[model samples]
Target: MESTSPMRLSFEIRQMSPQQKLPSPDVGGMSRSARVMALLGLQYTRPFHRDALFLFFFALGPAVWLSMTVLFALQPSPRHALWSPVFLSVALWQPLCEELLFRGLIQGHLLESMPKQKTWLGLSISNLLTSCLFSLAHLANHSVSWSLLVFLPSLCFGFMRDRFGSVYPSILLHVFYNGGYFLLIGSATR
Candidate 1:
């Protein structure tokens, strides 16, 4: 069995073949910053149509925003504006870390480990599994109804990740989602 060393694993995109073109999780030999940048580069998947229209429509469209609007109406946050540490973190850091872990790591992991063609109702089993796990991960942070509400968006985020063949789009969507909700919450509260 032949295994490439860490030094050889983190080569530039142009150095790899089309099949191996997708960036692997190999941050080997790279500086900490470079490794982070690479991991967040959104180059770690197969070729995709990569249309902004789809990203907007499917993940960040009117329907999604409306759902968020409804949620805000039902459960407007107690917090005030974006100044609060918690609100700021939720609008920014939370999405980044969550998407990085869920879409970038977990969903990607399912894609790598699960059967490619195994799907239900036109959704990949991996996507479904990732969505379920994503929802469950938030169980402690929210009530059962809220976690169930979260599951729907989890599916959307996972689909965005899969459709774009990268996590960047989903991350952006997550940011927009939280930011919008919080913005509404702030305004509605004050």
Candidate 2:
């Protein structure tokens, strides 16, 4: 008796061949920065995205320091008086720019070039280098002590970016962390 199932008794096969060339996606329409950011967004995983976000807060650190210095210089009579608006600006703008540059651009590129296991090392080195650059960028502000404190958090942000594979959370954590510092120190200073 013959089976009536859809199984075939004989099969035909064809030779496999690889394509000589692969087509590249069209990106000519996108602006350089836009294209780069889009690539970063895609390449980074959820955790890294979070980390990028956290790193964003570090951007505010220098700004906060500068604003405070300016206010203090202008009116040493009431140190705490300028906290209101500065605090809000730090909470808002710092994270946005920091994430854009550090986690989104810098770490994103590092992760692309290095192997997964080495991501931590890459992130650490990159974070240190960039953080130093970041700190130095504020040379005009000229507070070694503040820069040192900022460095610590920047390292934490780098670790966060490596562990999570995203910058979003990093920016959030950054904003909160720096904001807390601002509130605490500003309140105490006042």
Question: What lDDT tens digits, residue by residue, belong to model 1 across residues 1-190?
Answer: 3232222333222233334222345667888876555444455444333554444544554455566555556445554545688777877899989998888777777766543334444355666888898888888767666677778778777766765557876777788787766665453422
What is the C-alpha local distance difference test score of each model? 0.62, 0.52
Return the number of clashes found in candidate 1: 0
Q: After superposition, how far is residue 94 of candidate 2 from its true place, in Å?
A: 1.3
Best by TM-score: 1
Residue-wise lDDT of candidate 2 within 35-132, one digit each (tens)?
67553432343433323334455455555555555433322224554456666666557766776677667766655553322222223445566667
RMSD of 2: 15.6
Tell me each candidate's TM-score: 0.65, 0.52
- The all-Cα superposition gives candidate 1 an RMSD in Å to the true structure of 10.3
TM match of model 1 to true structure? 0.65
lDDT of 1: 0.62
